[model samples]
Target: MSYLTLFLTAFAAATLLPAYSEILLGTLASQDYPLFWLWFWATAGNTLGSVVNGIIGRQVDRFKDRRWFPVSETQLHKARNRFNRYGQWSLLLGWLPIGGDALTLVGGIMRVPWLNFVILVAIGKGLRYAFVIWVVLKAGAMAT
Candidate 1:
């Protein structure tokens, strides 16, 4: 049940919706939950959430002209320019806050291959969770 909660939180965090999984991961780590599963579930959930953004991005172009469209033309244009400048490699930064989600979306808009998208996102998010886990464990060690 705890792992499920963490997975869901991590998944939601990766989406455009506001959520944070790092804090939960840290809390669980300090409690001494299984480290590998915690990292695995968090990374998997987060990476899958970014995949959702990519999927939306692929279809979002058609909706840009609608009144309910969330992004302005100028904003989309600027995002496009930045994505193009950085190319697909920019997906590596999809783990970043704020701009990270947008980067994944732009990756879809630019039609980055799906395999590359998943692999890159997984790597970045996995590394982030690993760092978080390491920090929590290290801190706990010092406290003891």
Candidate 2:
């Protein structure tokens, strides 16, 4: 159940939603939960959530002309420019808090390959969770 909660939190954090999973991860780490499962579930859930955003980006154009479209042409244009400037390499920063979701969405808009997207996103998010776990463990050790 804890793992499931962590997974859900990680997944929600990866999306445009305002969710934060780091605190839970830190708490779980301090409680001595298995590190591998925590990292695996978090990475997997977050990556899948980013993929969902990518899928939405892929289909956004169909509704782009509608008045209800969320993104403006100017915003999309700027996003495209930044994406092109950084290239798919920017996908590696998908674990970042700000602009990260946009990076995944823009990757889809630019048609980044699925394999590449998954690999980069997973690597980035995995590293982030690993670092968080490491920090918690180190802090816990220092306190003892």
Q: Evaluated with lDDT, which candidate comes out highest?
A: 1
Residue pairs with backbone overlap in model 1: none
Overall lDDT per candidate, in order of appearance: 0.93, 0.91
TM-score of each: 0.96, 0.97
lDDT of 2 by residue, 41-140 (tens): 8898899999998998898788888999989989989999999998888999999999899999999898899999999999999999999999998998
Model 1 gets an lDDT of: 0.93
Candidate No. with top TM-score: 2
The residue-by-residue lDDT of candidate 1 on 1-144, one tens digit each, is 999999999999999788999999999988868899999999999999999999999997899989999999999999999999989899988999869999999999988999999999999999999999999989988999
Candidate no. 1 TM-score: 0.96
